[model samples]
Target chain A: MQNTPHTPSPETSKQLPELFQLLQPHLKALDAFLETQISEFEPEIRDHVAYSMDTGGKRIRPSLIFFSGWNSEGEIDPNLVKLAAVVETVHLATLVHDDIMDEADIRRNRATVAKKYNNATAVLLGDALFSHAVYLATQFPTTEVCRDIAISMRQVCTGEIMQTMQRGDPNLDMETYFRVIDLKTAELFRVACHLGARLAGFEDDYVKAAGAFGRHLGIAYQIYDDMTDLFSSEEKIGKTLGTDIATGKPTMPLILMRDRLPENEAKALRDTLAGNIEADVPYWLEKLREMGIFEEVRQAIFDEIHKGRNAIRPFQNNPSAAHLHTISELLWNQVAAL
Target chain B: MQNTPHTPSPETSKQLPELFQLLQPHLKALDAFLETQISEFEPEIRDHVAYSMDTGGKRIRPSLIFFSGWNSEGEIDPNLVKLAAVVETVHLATLVHDDIMDEADIRRNRATVAKKYNNATAVLLGDALFSHAVYLATQFPTTEVCRDIAISMRQVCTGEIMQTMQRGDPNLDMETYFRVIDLKTAELFRVACHLGARLAGFEDDYVKAAGAFGRHLGIAYQIYDDMTDLFSSEEKIGKTLGTDIATGKPTMPLILMRDRLPENEAKALRDTLAGNIEADVPYWLEKLREMGIFEEVRQAIFDEIHKGRNAIRPFQNNPSAAHLHTISELLWNQVAAL
Candidate 1:
């Protein structure tokens, strides 16, 4: 069912500006880490890849990875940073390929690899990232961590597949949507914390705690993404938003909103989506807003952030705890922005 | 430049046939091993993946892996067998995906995954197989082995990217072609043998020996494939074999054949390839046969096998020594079939 979008409170939004500042250095480290890993292959591979990667994004994934690792509270090795970068690269891989699968033309306010270099290059680049992620996965000290990371990869791929399958299916259920997001987006967040805990030599409960933290956070973040695209306009949101709705993505907000509609009105929304609308996005955009999906998803985002923050309660006292707190707060701040 | 088609022959191919056949049982055992390792996940994951895996192929990659483990004379753990099967699965992952990339309709006399289900299903199935392999990889006795196998995954993907880049480009060099094949097709073979030796408690020298054997054999196999695709009809080859000639792939036999062609004739062959002249397949086929490419590549296959056999001489006394011979026999037999 549709949940309303989470609009940010002015106070929370201002509070996390410092978190973005904190992420700047981590982003730099991540950029270098990414370059070095790609460099292991011929330079051309990295250059082609880095060109697309250099486009700016929020870098939320790496930040999550960092929080997970740094919170482990033991001697952190350079390997953790690499692993953090690995998490980001894996995300980048999914983004690059996902752009192609979705036939998306714009990402991060610029032409996607598929748009810039052509689909073949985008496909190859996506493959390279997948390859390189696995390549970089080896540096961890134990095979257990590496294996943990590897398992997460399957989840990511499976999630993407599920998303693709449900893509234009108006009848797509809410439960399947959550399962897809958990596997596709949240699993990495879960694994990132788990690996971070293991690398820090944290014991069993700590690992579980980190995993739960990342999983919930990731789910919250994705839900927020779904919410924003439906509720916010490009100018107001400060980016090109709402393509998900136009593409028949049947995101949570729309699902919830549709549930509240009269049967005829609901069927109209499905029919609109079933047309597989892509062009003149604003036309479909107006339809969804009229259908009350925007408010519904917005509220859902708020609830998710509330739940996500709750998941990290167990790790509050740990040294890396602040970063974890900051990451979640930054997410909450996004909801507050909505 | 275009080169004429030349089929490889078993009499002149690299590895031994009987050994490849012997490794078949081991390969089957490895598949069984994957089943055991896969059990912790939901049964749906394994059974869905098994749908494609159980259909099977010649078991080329795992055979190399089993021999690699055997090469070291280490205790045979079912783990190594499982590892070998997973490697084969990785190769399968590439094949299924590559078929999609190439828009191929068939693989091994059966409809390809993409053809059988659809692009979406095939992509997911390939990913599922990949993830399943990674999941099974966790069961290996050592993390080090896992790391090595993971690296092999990178090589496969990179090889694929490199090969894709070369597609439809007549300017691709023999050196570039070889490099692509080594990465795309041969790296797995190298790992197959290297893993065998490493698992069996073999030292660095043994690792090197097996690596050497796999590399040479893989190269020969690749070259043999090139030649057969050019010379054999699709009906006889059991696949739509002429993409190399069709897409202007600069494979070895073509490169060598081009060298032997007169300026005008070479120009004409290049013309046919650039045109993807399916109707004139016989015209190019005749041209390749007349240019003595059959003899040149046949000689090259003999050299690769000679080299492959020679590299394994140090392990001649190992229990898997017959395995190495069988691999060489299998390879040569493939050439002989051509």
Candidate 2:
């Protein structure tokens, strides 16, 4: 963890108003390609699926997949776009199912597919997305990328299962948390890099570079997730705050705080974690804050994002890779500001 | 439902010995492909998934898909192999999830994935299979194939939900049952056919024939399932008899028997359906037999299967398509014998 809080000082944070503009042409073509691909379905299913896909998700993973390839192989080939679509579809499938498993009512400020259409429909739709992803991975230029992407997907499932078990467990260790995060959050990002690089036929050092960049950015991205859970506004962050606490998952901040707690205070924190979500929220929040655990967690998030930015400093000169590098820095800056 | 009695009747049963033999080659391929795809995961997770797929359950859906192509287009292209594989995986995903939802200890004479693994793992494993199926489907050569497959997969999920809600209700109308069966079992079969026809690029009346064949066969298949539940050998059946009754879902005979039952007996049957699985199985079986419901159901099973054979007969010239037609007849013959 760093000295900065969840609300970072202006000096560390940056902005990227033109980033979307920069990526617009490729994004447009990607959307057009997907539209043509999906237009033949039962209209409602296709519309709902595309609605989720084009929900303007930060194209972070796809960008990594694209840029990693370009940096490694010196061009963004047609294969990168297809791989991008596949990776994004895989991510979308997880979100659709996660909403059902979590019973989450809202995501990205919209009714989740599970909430909007219904769980059964959501499950099927998610399966549809997943099926599309697997089918598309073969479109990648090589069998190697196909195999790696598919393996990463199974790893995502492993991560989801691991996370499901860890939920509501205050005693969850940091190792388990990282293991889960790495799978749930980082595996795709890591794969995104590898896929991009692989598509470019960048067989060695560049592949490692792409993967390393994604790994650090993914860590930074997740630390931002932790910070958002604790400190971001519902309007700005797009969901409820302290949701992890509400769900009783011992997230990074909470984990750091538990270790630092006095025995009696730690027991209080543990009790709150073990308590049912249907119980009193204010009482639990007060207890958590009274223990000074929240502040420690806030700082830990900033430190991770800071480390993430530093990790990418080596790739700044590559203009083709600039958007991805910029987004990582911007997200971290926003987390610090928040 | 048709006229088979609630006793061993192996002497009259028909077998798909030759068709199953023809399918043997592809079955081997399926096994090898599954091994390669899952071999990379940790052994524990790999085994959990493999236990479900590796079980030598019927490959009805895949056969339908391949045969649909074989019949309409005159040959089963090797390229369409993965399409069949994906459809089967979708079916297996539904079954794995169904086992958990049903809490069944056994399927195909062995423990289900849920029974073998804990419920949490089993649930996620089902999700993984669904994801993997989607991933696999993306490899289809055309976008329409992708969208059509997705639509069919959606139907399967909806069918499962319908079945769950209708479980244990003797009053479940036959129309509702038909719809449920169509969604749960028939839709995938239809998709399999649709995929087969789509891949073969039949692009005409052939598509309609393939779909019609699949839909009718799927219905016949479910009808035969009803007969098998009441009349087949415990060993031959691979699981306990009258399990659906135990779960409270009214099959054809039960539905008929409910209407035919003397007031007291009808009330008793209804009570059992509404009650827990702990209710005496023998008691219901005895009462059900006294009404001759089993015989009535078996006759109906024959009627449907015979209809299915007629529907699929147009494909008789193609070897793979001919086998599906023959298998449908044989399966029906087995039910009629029972």
Candidate 3:
């Protein structure tokens, strides 16, 4: 591995925010490592596998893995890179499947795997990506990495399943929403941090703390993501917006807005969510702003981020804890800016 | 572990052929073990997981694990049982995904997971099953079982992807058909036997021989399955028959029949397979029967089975070799009967 972190290219840096510059080297290594894995798939589907891997997401999980395992010497641990790749691959596989479920056309400013290839190919290609992720996890010397990954993978799917089952129910409670996000999104984040810290030779207590931090951070990140679907511009986010209500997926803002609406308006909203009536995206987006649900959702995210920071507060002297704090601050800023 | 093999219940015995009676105890243990795994999934999805696990498809892969690990004393090895569960779960997960891609409604005389549940649920449910399988594989003392399983899972997905990609292509050759079947079907069989024999403390040579046997048998089994799709009645097979032709999937019989037809007929057949023209299932079935394609496909299957049997001929002194031989005989008989 290179001793000095590589600089991100201008295009790449522009895609990511300034806060992520510190992870350029680690993410670079992860990209090279993932590229090497393309040949590992069957020759027939290598291109599809490569396409899914190149989605260029924010790499939040990889950042969690890197910062949680930070070394004062600033030498990137190769094991952490591999762990990042494993978690990121799992994340990408979920995205592929998620696109199929959402009937989503675009992701990361390009056609989704489901739109580009077909739903059937997207489904199997996602499975192929998942199998490859587990295969990579097994390359570790011990079973801990694979075991944790398998459990997290299962939880992620379970969370998605719960969300699917609850779709169009309209009365979806905040607890269920939180539970789903915790499983679908936070579970991988927790495992990434836990495994990253453990692999970096951190103490047991610190590892546990890092996991808690990740779990809280994951919850916060997901809320922000859910908010963006209704609030962010399609051009700025590089994807379709206002899909939550359109697809009848009850998110934090929708739930809050529903609760605050007048009885007749709420029934109409419920009817729309239940698919009994057509979804009016503009109406819901206006309601969200009128009800101040956007600021409320942002505050909810801020609270979770603060909880995450408090998790590693006792380890303030540790360099990893400091890095983790900085990363949480970045999330806080993003949410605030939104 | 039971010291004596349990007799299969009459209902199960009737469902399965007489040849599987020797595996009653092992299959029973696997069923119980798999039932216990239902609780391992999230509470919300446990029923769905249980439903998927109880499909009662012929446990050919588990049988391979048991037979290859057979001891003269007939004592069940818990390790082999766990190994069987791992491979079986992976197979079930693949079946769940396969039903979605094939748009298959019924499997093993009942609705497939995809049919019973929505496609999105089926997709995530399949993912959960795959994750659980890897988790089970990681329970072994060493990384070998999990490592081998992960690799096999990737190969299986790759094979399925290749087959999916080849779905409407009239020009798919015999080599690609063999390769797809090898990856999609044969990989799990090979891994089951390989891991089963290795776990049974068999000699290295015997372990390798068992894996070879599994690969050939797997190839033979797939050819037999493809043949049945064209030749069998719905009452006998319990699935929609002649789907390969309708779906434009070029299997062994279709490939053979296409090659043997005269120029004009062959062009028409090619057009049908390419979706340029509607498939005439009755005509193709008639062609398959008249062209001696059924007998040729049977011969192809027999060749694979014979090769499989020959792989373990040198290890006849080992009881496992005899048991493995008996399993091959079962496949041989099934093909002959077909």
Candidate 4:
């Protein structure tokens, strides 16, 4: 791995907000399309689906789709909005099921679907959303998008299954950790770009490049997210924080820390995790912080971000490609604060 | 609606087992294909998936696909085996998720996925299976089968959502009940036939007839299933029984009995259902049985069978179509004894 000190400054973070401002109209269109798509469901399901959809997020996937679609040098397809809804609904469906699996209460400062209704309703609701997303993908004239979506979906579930299987293993290797993230996070990003570029009628090379950019960016984003979950305050994140340890989920920081620690201390930490240490989590968190593991995690995030930016460096001069670069930089700036 | 007394005799029911004897080789081929399909998953997931798959049911969906595929007056495509696996996997995925939603323990005389594994693992496994099934569907040349699968999947979920919404409502109308079964049960059956016939290069009319056969048979199967759940011994059914009542699920017998009883008695029964009457279930079951609700339910099952068989009556002389009719009768025989 090439180590480059290309961390973004605070000013780099402001660019995304401006981009968001420029892209606000497209986002609104996606929102409307999503609402209309979900309206066909039964009234009860419609309410639950709307509730989950309306729970605001950064809309990162839609931005990727929109930006990638805009790169085609043609008028963006109206169908792109529908595609955005499909991807976002897919994202939302995964989150709903994730919340249930994690037994999480709050997400985006609100009760999770599993908590809001019940597990049974939440499970069926997730299934319904997934089916709806698949159906939406089928509306496209080509089977290519549906094929990509299906493969990406399978990979996502594979990641989840891998993660579930490896839960509580603090000694999980960095390779396995990266593999999990690659499947779980990066595959969706890769397909989002793949779909966006293909739908925009881009040639095969640019589509491949776009997918690479997304893959690296997604890996970087997930590493940064794992770091934030460990280091940031629950209030700052506006959702459940430090849950990776509590749930015995093997994430980057834990894997790194376990690898670096003395054998006895690593075993002790694992024992604590294996035991009823829910109340003792703060102590472990403080110890890991005092050990400066967060600094190492931050460095790892920067390395990933640098790799992500370099993948798209060839097209950085293009205005549309520059926007993608700026998004990567913005992600770096957010993680640098940790 | 037509109360025809065209019930099958024991001799007709006996034909299915003989057919199964002849079709054993095809069933084994399907089983082998299913194994290969699931073998691609991670070891942990592979075990869970295999465990769930091996805890066999009657292979009804695959039989539908196979019988329909064989309808063409030409050689059967090797791809049909993969399609059978896809449909069966889809069926298995739904059952896994449904078990989690129902908190069911036993299925096919063994522990359910949710019981054998944890709910989280079971949920992810179900999702992985669904994705795998979709991926398998995409392997075909045409987009039509994928679209049908996606739509059928969405409709199935819609039915589940409708059923979830109407839970505990003893006054669920017959029309709405039929609609739920149509969406949840019949859609898959319809799609199974549609795909099978399409794959076999059957004519459009035969395809339509096969789908009709599957749809009406699916509705009849669900009705018979609900009746079996109400009246059969758990040891005989080899699955958890009486869960519909415990979960407040509205099924045919309850609906029919409630509609047939005196208003005051119906209200009392509904109150008992709505309130804490877990221990009083035996008393309610006795009352319904004493009221000859089982007889009414049996008659309803026979009526549905008549309609199901009638849907494919045009091709009754064809060997393939006769097998379809025999399958429906077999399902009827199982529930008739209840």
Candidate 5:
């Protein structure tokens, strides 16, 4: 399997449906919007924030916001572009703090905000970005958009707090893991679609369908990400791999592996993870592979992707919906390739 | 002179003005509103947020929001109650993070949130509170109120980031000090009044004047706080003192002391401060007193209070406006007694 970056370019996206070409122009516009959105009076903050913005990743969340707003009739509101920028800023803010919490040195093939600057700077930058994003949301004429952003952010914080509390707990159950991912990842995706459809003045049913599509897409995306953490190399992933293991954070693969094994075998894996043997990554990697956990996790990812595909099945005939369907497919393919 | 807590109770507030008595009912309502606002799916978060809210301080910002909305004809919008709650939540969020940054053990005669909980919990709590507050702001029908809250939060972050960047610099000038306070402190205060007046549909001049009032009041309040840090004891203040000195974070007293002393003497003070003689707090305290820096700082506080009073002078003819005027007078009197 070739380890290609998941981030898509105009040329790469050309292989997808015609909707990809439409998305290209909007993604370019989002790039333009994001470039100027980070300016601050403080020179250092301005530069650091700009640096974080410039080291961009796959703009999946913003794409959801744009594509959700693009209905079958091919109508798009200009305001959805700003909403995309706002949601992307929120994502960036979370990444800044997430890096600090994980002590991650690299992200998107560059030093993280915490590593490049300092923890305090990174924390404050995250707060600044959050406030700026809220400011941008309020720039919209309707309170509904701003309200959705705030609620999504609240849910994000709640999920992070729950995840933080569950750290080092080897016995963290599957239910709690699902809840955490739902809040932390799926909530943002849900809100992206919610904001896009709502701002486009779609009916409540369409808006809800859009949200459902994003929620499943996001869940599958996160599950796929967990698989990559277990299977991918640092060179391929461009991040500090195995942090979830090192930090004793219970993710899908570990939970599934422990649950499937015999009681004694599960206990051994748990002890190895909970202990300080995490520095010897290859040993655990070999054990996990020998246990066939990656194969099981790949199946789990496919299961989620199936659910994700089913979520947007109603919108399949809408033409523009193909773009969203392609998103889930591309994410699964990216993970499967790794 | 006698030491008194600046956080007034119903009994103490009754001694000042009839307006305080009117504010009492609203403050109680806000207290009730806050009790229900901290709800999260995670029980630990709900409990921690409630605990932070339980350890109450001077509700000065909420009072500003309430009083600024008190029109001359005795009109008050019920929705302003929610706005007051929103502003107070933002203040609490900042306090939670501020305690972490300062490594403060106590606040409001109780363990600080970071001390009671861990730093991770404290950080997430602050973020949660911020998101909740913004969500509350968006509950308003118009976007103006939400936009004001967002802008105010941005300025607050800007000030904090600037302060964090400038940490351990002994030679921070008065201009920079003023700028930091104006952003970090006065901006929120200004917005509380701005939100209140705007929501109440006050005339443009009245809204502008109300903002000016809160700005000056906040500056005076912060300057008075800086003075107490230099002059008050830990027992009297009910919190850790001399953190600014210990952390080498430049404040008003150090700036004033340096400016007043001869070149060699100023250099010596800076060296003593910039070095790790923070444990010898009494020695620095004695030197500052001998140089009459406390007196100078008190005078500066008075100047700010005077400006604050002048800001609401035109409104004084209104019966409700005298309440705001009395606020500045009482604050000055409180500082003078100290």
Candidate 6:
């Protein structure tokens, strides 16, 4: 099995969505700004800092920040650029630590910090990255940016801790699952949009709406990600399928399947999830397909995306809202295609 | 050998120094303040946060802050209390992460967070604590507190990373050792004193001097800690001795001993540090005593303490400076007792 779930890197323009073309200059400034931050770290760990910062993920959170703070002048706001770097750096730091916990060797087609260095170095490096992110957040004029970023970071770790504790538990409920995703993934998304809009001098009402839009969109994105772990083919996703089941992570599809199966079958699946029995990935995959869990999970994703769209509907006249809607449309298209 | 070196917990009045008696109300305020922080964590992980924060170690950093910001009015400054909590929390967070890297089962006379829960939980808990610390730092009106704290946190992690990389390396020099300790240990101490004095509205020159005092005092304290890991007895220190040798961590005494040994003996010591052979800890310990390395290392610590005293000597008329001198004297007494 592949080490990590595959996600297309945003290195090439083709891999990015069409809306990203508008963010070309913003992202360019972000990349340059991030490059300058390597020197901010101590000389010894600068190489590791640079390596982790070069993750090349799709930068979805940065996109949220930029779009929510979009200006009519078409000029990059250095403050927004700094905010993007802060959020992206925090995301990258989480990824570094996550790789250690998952014991995964590969990330973005390169050796993870845990694999390249060691777990100890990976842990400390992740910490250094986190500290640097907060340091960047403190550069803002007011305490709001750092305060929001810090709270979001705490929530993100709390979500991850909850997930780790529930890893092999077969009875993780749907509500708990949603709560975890909200804290871990959506919290940062909410903060990015909220802070970006606030920093851009948006009206209070519009900023609140943007944050709600981001929260719902984040939920939708995580559901889609979890769905791909089970439903997508190795060829389609460029990574191994059924990893969520293999690793005994009770995601939406598996949770739904477990509840729908016969008592005997459900007991067997529970044993598999609890690691009392060897994981039969093919059997579970076949069972999920036969039970039509895929369509059910897809609907859940659509529902979240719809709710996200409804959040910003009242502010359609705002340019920032329009840009945010465009980003959501890109996600909608991806989900519909799947 | 025991899993970790022991430091006295400041739970008892007798265990504390004469000055801490004066700060009883201040320490009580810090405890109450820290207790309030527990609810700030997510409900799911509050127990773990509480567990890690109940370390009961000598709150040296907090003491530094309180002393550096001492007021003649004898009223506890809430800002100084918040600052103390921030630095102390950062210290505890580092200890949690350090326990994981050391794989030590015990810290401050209890199961470490890594041992009590798991490495993954410990990692995330440390992260949560760090975020909370920064969040508290942001509560101050200006960004200076958060900014200095973030930078110090980064340097602390950088120091740990360097030390981790240098593990089992036989050729680590004195200069690198000092550099690592300065980054890992002294940076926070320096920041605590600097910020404390600045927040108390002291003269700029005195603030700088206080920070210098803290830096030298931190150097002295770490040297004393490393000495305890090798020279002190399990009964005396209440944990273990010679762990540095067992763990292949080269400290001042070990380094001095290694360099002073005859060529063949030095090669064997180097090999032991490189983990090519079993560490004959008793032989090394006896050799350390025979060669008078204890006195040599002790002298190094005394030199740093003297330097710290000199840094504050010019500010003798100030109450804060006098308090800082008394703290240095406590360290001098501990070393003298050893």
Scored by lDDT, the top model is 6
Where does model 3 exceed 4 Å of error? A1-19, A233-235, A238-241, B1-19, B239-241
lDDT of 2 by residue, B15-124 (tens): 46755665666656666666676764544367666677887867777666665665432333665678777777777887876776666888877888777765656667
* Model 2: lDDT to the true structure: 0.66
Write candidate 1's Cα lDDT for B1-338 as tens digits: 11122332223222444444545677667767755655544443554465566555777777677766763323446756776767877777777777777788867667777787666656656766666676566666556666676677777677766766666665566788788888777788888888777877777887888888888888888888778787776777766655667676678877776666888877766665566444365666677788777877877877877776677766556666556755576566667666
* Isolated chain B TM-score per model: 0.85, 0.83, 0.92, 0.90, 0.89, 0.94
lDDT by residue (tens digit), candidate 6, A1-338? 11111232121122235567778899899999999999988999989988888888898999899999988765799989999999999999999999999999999899999999999999999999999999999889999999999999999999999999999999999999999999999999999999999999999999999999899999999989998888776898888988888788999899999999999999999999998999999999999999988888887877786677677777766778878877876776687677
User: Which is better, 2 or 3, measured by DockQ?
Assistant: 3
DockQ of each: 0.41, 0.18, 0.74, 0.59, 0.60, 0.81
Which ranges in model 2 have alpha carbons more than 4 Å from their true place? A1-15, A33-38, A47-56, A66-81, A138-146, A200-204, A233-239, A276-317, B1-39, B43-89, B99-123, B131-219, B226-326
Q: Model 3, range A134-212, lDDT digits (tens) per residue?
A: 8888889999999999999999999999999898998999999999999999999899989989999999989999999
Better of 1 and 3 by TM-score: 3
Provide the TM-score of the second chain in candidate 4: 0.90
Q: What is the descending lDDT order? A: 6, 3, 4, 5, 1, 2
TM-score of chain A of 3: 0.91
The CAPRI-style docking tier of model 1 reads acceptable
List TM-score per model, in order. 0.88, 0.67, 0.93, 0.91, 0.90, 0.94
By TM-score, highest first, what's the ranking?
A: 6, 3, 4, 5, 1, 2
Name the runs in model 5 displaced over 4 angstroms: A1-14, A17-21, A40-44, A71-77, A239-241, A276-284, B1-18, B40-44, B71-77, B239-241, B276-280
Best by DockQ: 6
Name the TM-score of candidate 6.
0.94
iRMS per model in Å: 2.7, 5.1, 0.8, 1.7, 1.7, 0.5
Native A-B interface contacts kept, per candidate: 0.35, 0.20, 0.83, 0.59, 0.65, 0.93
Among all candidates shown, the one with the greatest TM-score: 6
User: What is the alpha-carbon lDDT for the whole of candidate 3?
Assistant: 0.87
> What's the TM for model 2?
0.67
Model 1 CA deviation exceeding 4 Å by range: A1-15, A71-77, A118-121, A237-242, A276-296, B1-24, B35-48, B71-76, B240-242, B276-279
Better of 3 and 6 by lDDT: 6
lDDT of 6 by residue, B56-78 (tens): 87888998999899888658999
Clashes of 5: 0
Better of 2 and 6 by TM-score: 6
Q: Could you report the Cα RMSD, in angstroms, for every candidate shown?
A: 5.1, 7.9, 6.4, 3.3, 5.0, 6.1
